[model samples]
Every structure is written in C-alpha cells, then in structure tokens.
Target chain A: MRRIFTVWTLLSVLVCASQAQSTGSSDSETIKELMQEIKELKTRVAVLEARQGQPAPEQAAAKPAEPVQETPSAEGQTLSPERISGIFPGIRMAGFGALSYKANDARPPEAGLLGFRSGNNDFAIGDVDLFLTSHLTSKASVLSEVVFSENSEKEFELDVERLLLKYDFNDYLKLSFGRYHTATSYYNSVFHHGQWLQTAADRPLVVEFSDHGGLLPSQGVGVSITGKIPSGSLGLNYIFEYGSSDIHRPNILDPNADEIVENNGHATTIGLFARPDWLQGLEVGGSFYHDRINPDGGPFHLGQSIGSAHVVYLTPRFEFLNEGFIIQHIIEETGQKLNTPAFYSLISEKLGAKWRPYFRYQYVNAPLQSPVFSDVQLRHGPSIGVRYDYNDYIAFKTQYDRTFRRQLPDINNLLLQLAFRF
Target chain B: MRRNWKSIIVFVALLSLGAGCVISAQSKEEDVAVIVNPQNSLESISSAELRKIFAGEKLSWNSNTPIFMVVRAPQAHERDILLSRVLKMTESEYKQYWVKKVYSGDVPREPLALLSNGMQLEAVRAEKGGIALISLADVRQGVKVLKVDGKQPGTAGYPLK
Candidate 1:
C-alpha cells in the first residue's frame, strides 16, 4: 500500500508540474499579446494627440489620403477617442479622377462626334469626383457627391451630382430624399461617375447619363425607398423612386448650371432584384420608369415609359453583365408612338491579380422620327478593353471601340486612360 | 515485488493517458469568436447571416440599429479565418470589395479596422451595433460571444477557427 501511495504521489507531482509549465507558458503568451495590444493603443493615442495638437511641419507637405478613417459624431462634434468609438462614424470621403487620350476616325457629318474639343485625337481630363457621407444619427445619414468635370470647351466645371438625406427605419424600410442616381437599371445605381470604380474606362453607351447623349434619365431629384424583402435565402430587395426626369435635358450644353434641373415633368421608377444565397455575386433584377416627356424641341408633352432588365454576375475574378431596355413614347396630341430598344452585354476576367481584359457589345435602335432619341438612331458595335491595376488605388486601361451607325461609316476609336482613387 | 510491478504498470498507463490528453489539447486549433456588444440582444447568428453582415450586405440589425463592423488589420490570424471562412475572400479581394462598395455610395464607409484585439474589444463594447472577431483564447468579459451556426466556440461543428 505504501508503494502504491508513493507511485500515485509521484504521478500527481509529474502531472502538476506539467500543468504548471503549460499554465506559465500560456500566461507568458497572454502577457506578450497584452503588451502588443497596449503598444498599438499607445500608438493610436499618439496619432490622435498629434491631430489635436499643432500640425507638425512634416505633415504640411504631403499628407497621405487615408482610406475612410473613423471620425467623431455626425454633427462635427468632437469627443474623446474613447467616447467616440461607440457613438458615431462621422464623415467619410473618397475621391476619384481619371485622365484619358482618345483617337477616333470620323466622317464629315460625324466630325467631333466623340465630343473632343481638341480635334478627334487629343488628351482629355475626366471627372474629378468626390463622394462624402456623414452619419448624422444612429439611423440617419447624408451623402453628397460633387464632380469637377471637363467641358467641351476644355474647361473644368463644378457640379453637384447627388445630395441625399437618408433615414433607415429597419431592414425593410429605408428612405432617402434629394438628388440621387435613378435606379432605373442596375449599372446606373452601382457605378457612378468614378472611373476608377468601374472595370471599363467608360460606362456602356446605353446606360450613360442623358447629359452624355445616352438614352436614359439617369438622375433625378426626389425620394427613393429601398429595402430588403424577406424571402429566406432568395435574398430579394426592392427600390421605388419618384422625381423629376432629365430625359431631354443634357447638362453638356450648360456647364455652369449647378442647380438641379426641375424638368416640367415627374418620373416614377420601381425595381426588384434578387441575390440568391446559393450562387453568390449574382444579381437579377428589372425596373420600370414612367414619366411625361417635355422635349426641348418637339411637343409640349409626351407619355414615356422605360422598361429595363439586367442579369449580372460579379466576383473578384470574373464579371458578366447583360442588360436590355425599351423606351416607348406616345405623342398625346397626335396619337403618334415610337418604341426604341437598347441592349448591352459585357464580360471580363481578372487574370492573376492585376490584369483584367474585357469585351462589350451594345446596340441601340431608335427610329429617326422618335422625338426623344432621334439623335441616337441605330448605333451598335463592340468595345474590347484591358485594364491593368498598378495598385489598389490606380489603374491603366486601353480600349478599342468599333461603332456602326445608321447611314454612316463605321467609326473606330481607341482610348487610353489612367484612373485613380484616393 | 509483483505488487510493485503492478503499481508501476498502472502509473505508466495513467501517465501515458495524461500525456496524450495534453498533446491533444496542444494540437487542437484555437477558435475565432464572433463577438458583439453586450447590449446587443442577438444570441445566435447563422453562418449565412454572419457572411452577409461581414460582406456589408446587411447594414442594420433587426432593431433598426445600424451595424458597425470592426475587423482586425491585415496579417492577423483571426482576420485570416474571417476572410476565408466568413467572407470567402482574400485580403486583397476584401479591400477591393470595400473600395467598390464605398465608391458606389452604397454604404458610408468600410468596416472599422483595428490593429489589436484589445482595441477591437473596446470598439465593439462601446458601440451598440458593433461586431468583431477575436481569438477565443483572448476573449475577456464585457462582450457577448455569438454562436455561429448554433455552435459556440470550443464546441463541435463550430464554423470559425
């Protein structure tokens, strides 16, 4: 019995020793981790302190453009870092700019059709866009986008593209009021004027802004409601918007007008989309927009209806976009009617990490007699491009476009662009 | 002598068992816990829900509180787990995704990134809708641990590790 007791005691001692060793090791690791964390905290505190103090001489020369740094309260209220962490994510800013060189072959009638004031082959500066958002309260925020775009006369013009006040009631109810991009199609809402944010150097022709000689009323001033529709794994959402349509109002003619155009008519748009859980990065949706057209040259008013459908598949490495639209107009006075159809399909693949090559085909068929889109009659062709991302913030893109137009020779254009985000 | 031999045998067997248990414990992978503010009423989150929240798709909670997401900076081990299992994205892809999302004007900003779990904890605790991921071994008081797919950390079938 003594022998057994002695063995058991030995075993207990060995076990205890092992456990003690393990516990000590764990404690050391924990202490090391704590020390690292404390170091990080100290660094953060130092940065904050520096910001609170007089600006250092070195900081004045070249300040880094931080990526969406955290801010205090939405009202520009200052608080201690400790107090601010939980309260509000104040104002966030992102900027995008691009520079492009374009060369195109044009006939006499279509001379300068590319909108390049410096002949058909020249260097041009694109939009310098700034996007800002301020979270006013827990459920409310304000979003504003201002762009400095180059005009046809080779001058920069300031434009306030969007100014919205948004409120969120829940997952099922979100409302925004003011100027916003019309959600008439998937691309218009997803890709803004930020060239760096888009895979291609330019937007597809069919979805481009009306100001850019595109077919759609891509911007509006009014209220938009969007929210998730509880469909359990179907991942459905809806958007409803009502505002003034800019169908016949192209801002290209007036670069100094910063005021939101209040066209003589109102537009209403409703859309539904689904992002299924099973197939990630896939979106299928459609929207219908109705409005009364007051074209600048034609009649006083015309009934207009636009129907759009889109299917997009996007991942980090691949992209597939297919969209179709039909615009119908009826002259209420003469009972005259016109229907215009447009479509675009884009496909791209990201090779490795930096290089992305893409192909797009687009078509637009608007009869020359159509009051709204007579200028954009029967344009169709393909654009192939390759984009090389120099880094996360910068990209270089080269594109070749071949456009076939009605009663006009096929036009060829090449664009080289450099886009960056800060 | 024979009885002493039997005791020795028993001692050896027990020691072997104890050593096996220790080895197993040491070899097991540490878990990553999905933590939120203690004031949050959520007790459980499905893997799908977790994915959506982290992906910035689900912006607000059921209570209408805007969800503030906090994540560890790049190269953190817990962040790797989050990128792979939760978001199914690489670090670069995640960054690109946020850039696109922010530039698209969908959300206000990207998720708040912190350099340390300690700071992450402080941020999550202070914000009512804050959520973060940290090592289970580093979990302290004052934060609620959410069950992913109905399984808690250190339990079988837990998705995050």
Candidate 2:
C-alpha cells in the first residue's frame, strides 16, 4: 500500500505540472489578445481625443482610405468603400461627376430671357451628384441627393434632386416622405442622377432630367408607399405617390422648353413593376400621372394627365430599355385640349468587361397647340454612343446625335464625356 | 559589457522563437468556434443554418425574437473563414451584395460589425439573441460555442477546417 501511494503521488505531480503549464499558456494567450485589443482601443481613443484638439490631424488619419486610389485593375472597386460596412448610425456619402465637350450643328439655342448665357461649343462641368444615405434605426432611414450643374450664367448651380425619409413596416410595406423622383418610369426614378449607374453618358431625350426638359414631372414633394406583391414567383412590386410641385409651362415661340402647361400643381402617380422569375434581368412597368397646374401669378390653370409604360432588360452582357408616354393637357378657362406622344428606346451590348456600344432612338410628336412643340416642333432623333469603362470608377463616352429639328436641316452634334464615381 | 548584452539578446531571440512555435501548434485552424448567447437553446446547427443566420435570411430564433447578429470586421481571420467555408463570398463581394440589398430596401438592416472579439462577446452578452464566432480557446461563461454540422469544433469532419 505504501508503494502504491508513492506511485500515485508521482503520477499526480506530473499531471498537475502539465495542467498548470497548459493553464498558464492559455492565460498568456488571453493576455496577449487583451493587450492587442487595448492597443487598438487606445488608438481609437487617441483619435477621438486628438479630434478635440486638432481637426485636421484627425481627418488626415481617418481619411487615409483615399477615394481616388489606383483601382485601375481591381473589380473590388465596383462598390464604393462607403457602401461597404455601411451600417446604421453612420453617414455614408458618395458622388459622381462628369466633364464634357459638346459641339452643336447650329448656333446653340439662346439662354434664358434673364440674359443667362451658355456657350454651344466648350468644355463644361457636366454635372455633379452628392448622394447621402443614413440609416437612423433598424427600420428608418434617409436618402438625399443634390446635384450641381452649370447655370445659364456660366456658373455652377445647385439643385435639390431628391430627399426622402423612409420607414419600413415590414417586408411588404414601406412609407416614404419628402421630395422624391416621381415614379414615372424606372429609368427616371431608378437611374436618375448617377451617371455611372446608367449605360449612357446622357439620359434619353424622352426621359431627360426635369431641368433638361424631360417630358415627365421629375421632382415632387410627396408621400410614397412601395412594397413587394409577394406573388411567390412573379416578383411583382408596386409604388404609389401623391405629390405637389411648381410647374414650368412650355410655350411655342417661347424659349422655355419642357416647361409644364401651368405652374405649381398637385400631382398623383401610381406605378407597378414586375420581374418574371424565369427571366433574370427583365422588368416591365407602367404608370399613370395626373396634375392640376395654375400658371405662375396668372389665371390660367392646365389640367394634365399622362400615361406611361416601360420595359427593361439588364445584364452584365447586354441592356435594353424602352419607354413611352402619352401626355394630355386641357385649358381650365379656354376649354382647349392637346395631346403629346413621346417614346425612346436604348439598346447596348457589352463587347467585354470594359467596352460597351449602344444605339438609342427617341421621338416626340407634340401638336402645334401644345406649348412644348410650339417652339421645339415635332422632335425626332437617333443617338449612337460607345462607352468604355476604364475602371469601375471612371468611364469615357463619345456620342454622336443626328436629330431633325423643325424647319431646319438634320442637326448633327458630338459629345465627349468623362464620368467618374467616388 | 557590450559583448555580454549581445549574448543575452541572441539567447532571448532564440527563446521567443521556441515559444512562438509551441503557441502556434496549440492554436490550429479548426479551433474557431461559432458562439452564441447562453440564452439560446441551439446546441447545434447545420452549416446551412449558420450561413443563413449570417446572411440575414434567418432573422428570428424559435422564440420569435429578432436575431441580432454580430460579425467580425471584414479583415478578421474568423470572418474570412466563415465567408469561405459557409458564405462562399469574397469580402468585397459580400459588402457589395449587402450594399445592394440595403439600398434597394430588400432587408431592413445589416448585421452590426464589431472591431474585436471582446466587443463581440460583450455585444452578444448584452443581447440574448446575438450570435458571433470566436476562437474555441476563448470560450467562457455567459456564451455557448455551438456544435456546427453535428461536429464540435476541433473534432474530425468539422466543416470549418
């Protein structure tokens, strides 16, 4: 028995020594990890504390993730760094800008009556879009986009394109309020200001930006609701928006183009879109919009109704877009009625990851009685452009447009553009 | 004096190298554990379930409470492992996917990203429905390291390896 006790004691001692060593090893490892974490914490604390003392130093340290880093080869640049790691309680900002050289076939149309002048053939700051998105909570968020473009004054002009506060109730219901891009067409609302997000350097003539005289009411202060239809496989979505806006009535012989039939009106728009499960990159949608506009400080009010339809197929290899609008206007006091028809189609085939060639055709048949065609009569055109994406961040596009303006020979113009998103 | 100091320095460098070898041998690649709060009843889950949870598809537990997921930073080692073995996406692709989903209003929120395992532990502790992953050696009280695919971490046939 005494011998057995001695052997057991020896075994116990060996076991204890090994156990103690393992415990110590783990303790040291934990301590090492803790120390590293504390170091990282200390660095963050230093930055915060340094911010209180000097602003520039903190910014310099935090801004080391340069936006313009030579992303010349990496597909990782497809999404901005701000978009990644973009959780709530954070402010993410992104923007895209373009520089363009435009030459017209004719002496360019004169600028606004206020003597605001824009040159026909000159290198110009095409446009800049500042997009801000904030997720305030798990279910609430805000998105705002402001655009800066050249005014007729040959200077930069700032425009508030869209500002919206959205609240999601569930997977099927979301409420949005504030200024929004009207749900007139998918291209108008989905691919509005991000030139890099769209296939073309410029919007189709029929779906041009509102300030550029597009046929639709592009901007409105509204309450909008959107949600999926939960069709199991049909993949249906719907949007409803009621909004108010100041209208710009177009006039024949009046330099104002794409102006509304009246001024400052209330509008309602409803649209539905669908993506068939069998087809991956296809979407079809339709919308109806009605407005009651009263002229600026004038007695005449224009009652307008518009019907629109669109079909789009998008893929990495090819993209096709077709949209049409039928606009009807009635004079409130004079009992006059007018009808305007507009349509455009864009088709693009990717030559490779970096090259894309596209063709677009658009037409507008506005009657003489309508103000839009009064000056810019029955408009029709074809535009051909080739786009080369240098990297995900930059693209170069050159488009040649051959258009027939009323009472004039066929007009040919060339536009060369460099567009970048950061 | 200078000669003696140089001799001591070399000896210490050799000692460190020996210690590093032993420590690295202890911390093997299969030792990462998928951890969850103690309040969860999930003893084990399939790799598909874990993927669904991390991808924001499985938003609720059996009790009908929202699942609050805590993920390591994109550059974290465990995250890289999780993405490779389970999520099957590059860090950049994952980010882009989440960006599109969030921006397009597909899901209401994205998972909270923490900078360190300690922060993740604290977050999980604070939220009963929270889930994260850590080194198995780091597991302690108040959290449970779940068995993945019916195989405990560090065991044979474990998918994480």
Candidate 3:
C-alpha cells in the first residue's frame, strides 16, 4: 500500500508543474502585447509634440484662397497713416561736412580783406551743417539749418543759416515766415548752407555769403509768398518778399565784427520765373529788391535798391546759369546814390559719368569811397573748377580762382576740397 | 502579373514630396491691382488724378473723403510696375521725394506700407477710403477695382498695365 501512494504523489506533482508552465506562457504573451502597445503610443506622442512645436499662424482670413503666385514679402513695419507713417513724428534730418586746403598770395590786415583763400592754406574743416525739418500738419512745416564754419579769423563761428516755417494754402500758394535765404538769386534760394550742392568748391567772388563780402542781403527775417503763376503750359512761378535785414561793413566801422547789424533796416523784393513747357529744364527769372537801412546814427543811412535778372538751363548732361544785379545805395541823409553793379555766369558739362568741369566768371564794381565796399568792392575774376563725385554721398573738387581787386595786386588761389553729404 | 512593392513605395514618396512643394508655392503674394474698399462710390479715376494723388500733390477725393493711400514696400514687384508706369519715379526717388514732402510739411504723413497683396487687400477692405495696388488674381470679393484712365484691368488703355 505505501508504494502505490508514493507513485500517486509523483504523478500529482508532474500535473501541477505542467499547469504552471501553461499559465507562465500566457502571461509572457500578454507582456509582449503591452510592450508593442507602448511603442505605438510613444510614436504618437512624439508626432504630437513636433506639431505643437511649430509657430502658430495668424488669424484665418475670411476669404477663399485664390490661385495666386506667392513671393516673399518685405520685412518692415507700417507704423501709422499719413500723419506719421514712415518716420517718427514726420521728422527728417540731413547734413554735410567738408574739409578744404587752399593757398593764396596776399599780405596781412590787407590780406584778410582781399583774396579767395584769405585764412586757408592747410587742411582744415570747412563747414559742418545740420538740417532739421518737421511736418507739423497737413499745411504747415518747419525747417532750420545751423552751421559751424571756419571763418577768416581762424576761429569757428556758429550761425543760424536759415530758420523758416512754411504754410501751404493750396497747390498754387505757399507762405513762409521766419529767417530765410533771400530769394534774390536761384543759387541763393536753392542752395542755402550746404556745400555739397554747389558745383564749385567756393562760390563766385561777388556771390559769396553776406559775411564773406557778398553785397546782397543773402538772409532776411520776414514773410514770403511763392506760388505757381497758373499759366497752364507756360510753367510760370512768382515770389514776393518783404523782410528786414541788418547790413554791416567791416571797413566802415569794426573790421573784425563777423556781421554788422544796421539796427533799423527793411527790404522788399519781388521775383518772377518762367519755364516753357516746350523747352523743358530751361528757366528764366528776374528780381527787384529795395532796402532802407539806418544804423547807429551814422551819417550814411543808406537806402538800397537792387534790380536783377537771371537765365538758367539745368540737365544731367549740361548746366548754364547767369545772374546780374544792380545795387543802388542812396544816402537817406543826403540824396546821393552809389551804384554797385555785379554779375556772375557759370557753365558746367558732365563728363566721364562722374566728373563735372565748370567755368565761372564774376564781376563787381563799387564806388571809390563807398564804406561798404570792403573786400571785393571792385573785383572781377574767372574761376575754373573740376568736381569729381567719389560716390553719391562724397565729392572731390579742385578749383582755381584769379581775383583782380581795384588798385590791388591780382591774387591767385588754388583750392582743394573734400565734401561729404549724409 | 505581380506588383512591384518597391516601385509603389517610391511612387508614393515622390507624390508626397510634390504635394508638399505645391503647398509651399501656393503660399506667396501677387502682381498688381488697383484696390479700394467695397463701400467707396468711386467707379473710375483719370490718370491725371491718379498722378496727383500718388504724388501727394492732392489730398482729398471728389467726394470730400480724405484719401488714404496704402503702398507696397520697396522692391516689391507690383510697386515697381505702379511707380514706373503711373508715378514716373524710381523706388529710391519716390522714397526721397516723400521724405522731402513730409519733412517739409507738404503732407502730414507718408502713405502706409505693406508687405503682401493679401495685407493690402485687407487694409483696403477694413479702412474706409483706403486705396492700394495689389495683384489682380489675388483680389478677393471685399475690395473694389478702380478704373484707371477710365479703363479697367485687362483693357489695353489701363494705366497700371
């Protein structure tokens, strides 16, 4: 009976072992399926993460997508409407600086009052100018130019060249009030304090700035109205001016003063210009100016008047400019009048695409005893210059000036200038 | 006949790549159109009036509505076409001219600039009296086309063309 019982126990153990093995196999299969499911889930998660990482698009447009060819658009900001669209507050700033080297033959005391290159022989900064302009409203604007210049005294002088506020009534009329360049000549009105716009390194002898022996009141504080002449195809324009200016003479009082303030003076001017539609780029203009100046109880309280005429033709290939003005200074104390006549003509031709060779002649005549006739009171000369544009923003100019003053030795000057515009 | 599984796989891959390319190419902007808001009563404009408007020489339209101009950015293809044809100015020249005008108080501000025709169209549609030059094909239903020189697009005398 013991042998039979042991045999039964062994068989029972074997059955149990078989059953455990089957259960383990099923568990292994379930574990394998779970591992495969986890792998698929991980792939889906990665895909979702990638999609989320991309940048969000802008608002969906409300219109149907059309079949339009797509190109890259510009990257910039459109900040506002016309009130201040492109620039902040509608302000624009631009300016220029220049360096010059010049030499001349003239002696002291007399030298400062005579030649073109009076105090210039070494490389020195000529002028640094700053221009600020702003649009205040649809009809109003403000512009000002301040300059730092190296004068004949070998010192820097700061000058407010022009400060003006302009108002536009319509397409045909514009009124400006403030200190501005007198509209006596085309060059004076167009090119104020910037040397970069000038063809020659230096202005003509008689057409220099007021402080530099120019006879006209180059700048005035006043009111001016300019407009188109409404002549259909005649292309006519007109400018009327009433202003106040202080005329000073170095030799008459203090030869060292940069400017003479005549204290009590007024000037009136009228100008007309015409450009025929048939012959484009050609303009003819003339001006009449009168001044009544009395300063400091001087015996010569002068009443001055000027009549001028001009002809100009400008093109990229060629340019011609001519101007002549008659200056009559009548002594308010006496009825005596001194006639000072001046004229300048210039012509330029563009060559080599970057070079402009220009020729200019200037003539001025003043009375022998006129106190205002200091430097070029009786001077006439021919100036030759060649200007080469290094690029759009920089230029190099070399000019030769032959100055002949009344009863004085003829002075010869050669000037080299490097000017930049920004 | 047995199908080649490898060839089928290659064909599918190329098809997907081509589809991706087409989708990307369709995402760009357009050529040129004279666009205005649908509410504007302007039907056509003469070439002279167009010149005066774009030049900032004139500010208001005939209806006394203050015209607001929306411009394409510089170097934009449509800008090149419109400026050369109507304004007779290069891109840089136009920019400089506008600078002078605004700083000189001629116009209170310059025209608005946008990158794409899509944006231009939206601006014209949203803003009353707004005008812009856009691509004709891309022009949708919200904006109206102004007849230039009394001629609409596709006509030989159209100024923008």
Candidate 4:
C-alpha cells in the first residue's frame, strides 16, 4: 500500500510537470506568432510609407512647395470619401447650399424686404456657395468664394463674393489683399454666407448686405491687416482695413466692364476685440468705420461713420450673441447729421447632440428722410427657430418671424430650410 | 480515492495557469506617446501648446516648418484620449470644429487621418514636419517622442495615459 501510494504521487508529479511544459511551449509559440506578425506589419508599413512619400503624378508636376494633401489607406481597395482628397492635392474645397420653403401673410410692395418675397408662399432656392482655398507656399495662400442664386426673374446669377490673397508673417500680423467682407461687424466677419454655420435661418435685418437693399457696405476692395496684440491672457486682437467702400456703387464692381471704374472714395475701419483665456468662448469687441458716400443724382457727398459693438459667448452647447450699431450720416454741405441705431440679441441652447432651439430679437430704426436707407423704416421683430442636425454635415431648420413696421401692418412669416455643407 | 486526489491536483494546476494567462491578457490603461519627426528640435510641449497644435490654431513650428499633423481616424482609442484630454471636445464637436475652421479659411487643410499605429509611425518617419500620437508599445526608431508637461510616458504622474 505504501508503494502504491508512492507510485500515485510520482504519477501525479509527472502529470503536473508535463502540463507545465506544454503550457510554456504554447505561450512561446504565441509569442513567436506575435513577433512574426509584428515583423510583417513593419514591412508592410515601410512599403506603404514609401508609397505615400512619393507624390502623385499630377502633384509632381505641380509646385514643389505644396505639401501632400492626404494618402489613402493601403487596405482600402476602393476610393472612399476620405480618399477623394488625394485628387485635389493641396487645394481644399468646401461648400454650403440651402433650400427653403416660405409662407408669409399679405404685405404691400413698398413694405417688402429685398431678399424676402411679400404676400406669396413659394419654394425658393437659396445661395449655392462654393469656397475654395489653396496654399501657394508655407506663408502665402489664396481663397475664393463664388455664390449662385436665383433672381426675381428666376434666372441664375453668378457672383464672386470674395477673392483674397493672404500672407502671414507671424501670429501677430497677417496681410490680405483683394475683395473681402468688410470687418465692420462681427456677423459679417464670422458668419459670412454660410447659412448652415449660423444658428438663425437668415441674417438680421440690421446687418444685411448693401446689395440686398440693406444699409451697410458689406463688401470692400483693398488691403486688410489683422493680428494678435500679445496681451498675456486677455487675448486681444485687431483688424485694420483700408478699402474701396461699396456704399454707393453696386457690390459687384462689373468684372466684365469695358473700363475699370475706380471707387469714388476710400473706407477705413479699425476694430479691436478680446477673447480672454480665463473665460473660454467669451468675445467682446468694438469697431468703427469711416467712409464718404456720394449718392447718385445728389450734388453733395455724405460723411458716414459706423460705430459697432458686440459681446458674444459661444460653446458647443450654448451661444449668446449681442451686437449694436449706430450709423451716422452727415450732409457735408449743411453739416446736418442723422443717427440710426440698430441692435440684435440672439441666444440658443442645444438640447442634445442633434437639436438646438434659438431666439433672436432685432431692432432697426432709420428716419424716413434718411438719405442712405430711405426705404428702411422702423423695423423691430423677434425670430424663434429650432435647428435639427441630421448629421454633422446637414441641418434642418424651422423658423418663425414676426416683423412690425412703422406705418405698415405687422407680418408673420414661417420658413422651413434644409442647409448642408460638403 | 487516490485517483480522485491526483485528478484534483492536476486540474488545480491547470486552472491556476489559465487564470494567470487571462489576467495577463486583460486590457489596461496604457500610456500614449506624442511622436514627431526625428529632425524636429522640440523636446517638450505644454498642455496649452498641445491643445493649440492639435486644434489647428498653430500652423508652423518654431523652425518655420509648416506643421503636418496626423491623427488616428474616428472610433480609435488614441483619438478618444486626444479628444477628451487635449481638445476637451467630443468626437462630433471636433469634426464640426475642423469643418468650420477649414471652411472659414483659418487653416489651409485639416490634419491627415490615418488607420493604424504602424501607419502613423511610418508617416511621421516620412515627413519632416509630421507629428502624431501612438501607444508606447508601438513606438519604434526613427521617430522622436515628445514629453508632455515635462514628463515622459510610463513615469509616475504622467499626464497622458
């Protein structure tokens, strides 16, 4: 019995030892397999990196300073949306387009807004804007935007919104030359032409473009200087622009005319703003614009000065924007001055990842006899909207607007819009 | 009874070994290394500076080299870490931010998104101005790993993991 017990003990010990050996061997085999996989991956990576380092056939013929845009993954056999970037090389393209359906109450022709149809409910095609940008060098770049929209005659009108060549010296100084949106207001500079980017369905009446029968000179041609002010945590910045004002002339300066029409007068604008690091998403700023306007068929020129201030707080889930403008026009001959005050306050909060509700109250009052904005009588209103983002690239907005005019009856309008970016 | 005892002993041994393997194979929070081209002179970066670089606010390096940023594609563990820790933005927010930035002409182009750590390393190796982040285990030669907040990966009190 003692021998039997010893034999059993020996058998158990042998069994355990064999089991340990087999397990150790299996682990080593796994390690070997892993090492081999790593080696293969390294080789594959090297080959792919080599291929990516080589520029495409079109890119090779292009300028040497242009960097490679993006490379498609080796594992993808077909061209995906991300791979489409390789086709453009250094040039990047983005665009925004909107389609809208509007329903409004009856309104007279004289009280009609320029962009909005009065007393009619119809489906409308908003602007189809194409924005293109290319880096010519490390510090120099070019940007161009073209917009296509339907006119009252139902014909497509092509407009070049902006064409700019920019050079960056450093973080503190950047110089840009060409046609750009005037930096006299925050909305003009921050939310130019992208309906999808802005929270509201349309621009505030006070800051609308001059071409649309609005008051402000929205476009300019000349040089702009923008830079940071190096205020430790205050994050101050400045924009100084000297350009040809489009107040009296058409915003489209006749790109195909026989002779280039020189601007009658120059416009100068100076603006300063701070985005403090201590409080994220807070921006407060003020801007002043000076220009001389000679209205058509008028014998005298008017000295124009626009003073604007804005306080904006924006976050991923919430936004608050408040801006005010005091537009002063003085008749040079009689020294008579007219002041028109306008303001808008907008607030929005995101309910979840896809839905955001917003409200805006706007007021603009221009005297009936005002020379620049004779048609713009007293207009104050409230706009409430809810924007639902179908995805990151597309948004659906439903907005209701109520406008009260000085001598005209109040009008209610409802708009449903689909805005998208690509 | 002897046979039962032997079987129990063998079974216990095997069970312990299997449990050891399982525990060793369980995933842990590992350190992520910020890698750049070996030719890059930067050795350390601050949290704010990292945020700015990854956010596309800083376009050029100190040497006047146009910075080429590379990032892992969406749904990647490394990208999650970057979005939460560095940018303080969600994935959708980050995507929207870049779309706005590029469309607004603030930056000429968005960062290149790649697939795997191996590809990221290789891309960094190929481009002189390239910068990326990868797991410490995947870091190889020919790329320089920058210290975040003066602390290297795997050290005590490392900022990124």
Q: Which predicted model would earn the best DockQ?
A: 1
lDDT of 3 by residue, B68-152 (tens): 7888888766787668876776554465456445533445457877655655654565455578887677677667888886777
Candidate 1 CAPRI grade: acceptable
Candidate 1 lDDT score at position A193: 86
Which digits, one per residue and each the tens of the lDDT, describe model 2 over residues B37-80? 66678899988678767776455676644567788887776787
Model 4, residue A356: distance off in Å is 0.4
DockQ of each: 0.28, 0.07, 0.14, 0.27
Q: Where in model 4 is the C-alpha error above 4 Å?
A: A1-90, A109-116, A248-264, B1-28, B126-128
Q: Candidate 4 at A390: error in angstroms?
A: 0.7
What is the i-RMS of every prediction?
9.1, 13.6, 11.6, 9.4
Fnat of each candidate: 0.36, 0.00, 0.03, 0.17
Estimate, for each residue in B1-161, the C-alpha lDDT of model 1 and write its tens digit.
Answer: 66776788789889989998998665446788999867689999999889889898999888877888899999887788889898888787898899888666677668888877766765665467889999898776667899988999999889887
Docking level of model 2: incorrect
Off by over 4 Å in 3: A1-87, A107-120, A249-264, A295-297, B1-74, B78-154, B157-161
List candidate 2 segments past 4 Å from native.
A1-90, A107-119, A249-261, A295-300, A332-336, A349-351, B1-161
What is the lDDT, from 0 to 100, of the residue A268 in candidate 4?
A: 95
Evaluate model 2: give its TM-score: 0.65
Give candidate 1's error at residue B156 in angstroms.
3.6
lDDT of 1 at A310: 95
The list of candidate 1 runs beyond 4 A from truth reads A1-90, A109-115, A247-264, A297-300, B1-28
For residues A228-322, what per-residue lDDT tens digits would candidate 3 score against the true structure? 77686577889998988765543412345445545546788899998766564588999988877764456678777788898999654577989
- Best-to-worst ranking by lDDT: 1, 4, 2, 3
